[model samples]
Target: MEKLDVLVLLDVSGLEDKEKFEKHLKKEGFHTVPDEAFVYTAESSTTTFSTKAYILEVFKKGLQKNTFLDANLIFLLNETPYPAYYYDKNSNDFELSESKEAI
Candidate 1:
C-alpha cells in the first residue's frame, strides 16, 4: 500500500492540560508542522482500509481520555482533498465535516 499523507488540526484551545495532550501526540508518532500551531502530519500505510476509514480510526484513537476535544483530519489518497472530520461534543466523537475548511 502507498503511504498516505495526513494533515491534522488539533484544537486544544479549550483544554487545560495542553502539555499532556502534546505529549500524547508525540507518543502517537505525529510530527508537528513547522511554524504552525496545533498542526501535524503523519504518513500512514493503509493496506486493509480506505483513506477515510484509516483517518477516522486515527482521529478517534488520538482523542484525550475523559475529555471532549475537537480535531480536523485531512488525508490525501489520490490527490484531491478528502472530507475532514471534527470532534462533536454532542456525540463525543469525530464526525465528518462538509468541507475541509469547516470549523
Candidate 2:
C-alpha cells in the first residue's frame, strides 16, 4: 500500500488524558503542526487507500480507543482530493464531514 499524508484536526475539549493521547499520536507517527490548535500530520497507509477503512481499521481499534474517549477526530487526506471524514467517541463509524467547525 502507498503511504498517505493525513491531516488530523483533533478536538480534545473534554479529554481527560490529553498527554496520553498526544503520546499515542506521536507513537503513531503523527507530529504536531506549527501554529495550529490540536492539528497533526502523519504518513499513514491503508490497505486500499480508503479513508473509511482506515478509520475503522486503525482509528477505531487503536488511536481512538480509550486514549481519545472524549475527543473528536477530523481526518483530511493531505495529498489527495478526497472529502474529509469525521469520527467521534460515541460513533462506531465515521462519515463524510458536514460539521463546519471541524473543516
Candidate 3:
C-alpha cells in the first residue's frame, strides 16, 4: 500500500482515545497515527513517493513547529504532484483548497 494523508482537526488540549483512534483506523485498513499532528492514509487509488514526502513534511510541521495550530482552519494536501483536499474548519464555514508548492 502507498502512503496517503488525512488532515484531522485535533484539539489543542490533546486528543481523546488516541490509541483507539489509531486502532480503529488501522482495523478499517487505513494507515493511521492518532497522536500525529495530521492523519494520513495509504488507501488512495494510487500512491506516489512525492505524496508520501508531502504528508511527512506537513505532519512534521504540524507536530514540531505547531503550524497546524496557526489557524482555526487550514488546508493541507497529500504529498503529490496533484494534491488532495484537506478541509480547514477554523472559519465560520469550512475552507478547502489544494497545495501548489512542493512540500
Per-residue lDDT over 49-79 for candidate 2, one digit per residue giving the tens place of the 0 to 100 score: 5654554354444445554444456666755
- Residue pairs in candidate 3 whose N, alpha carbon or C atoms collide under 3 angstroms: 4-41, 5-40, 6-40, 51-79, 72-90, 73-90
Candidate 3 RMSD computed on C-alpha atoms after optimal superposition onto the true structure: 9.4
Residues 1-103, candidate 3, lDDT per residue (tens digit)?
Answer: 6434544332333433445544554554446455565344544434455544544344333433322332222223353233333324343222234544322
RMSD, one per candidate, in order: 3.1, 3.8, 9.4
Which regions of candidate 2 fall more than 4 Å away from where they truly are?
Answer: 45-52, 55-70, 81-102
lDDT values, one for every candidate: 0.62, 0.59, 0.40
Between candidates 1 and 3, the one scoring higher on lDDT is 1
Pairs of residues at least 3 apart in sequence or in different chains that clash in candidate 1? none
- Please give each candidate's TM-score: 0.66, 0.58, 0.32
Q: What tens digits encode model 1's per-residue C-alpha lDDT throughout 1-103? A: 6777767666544565555665666776677788987776777676525545655655565564535444555554445566667777777667778665734
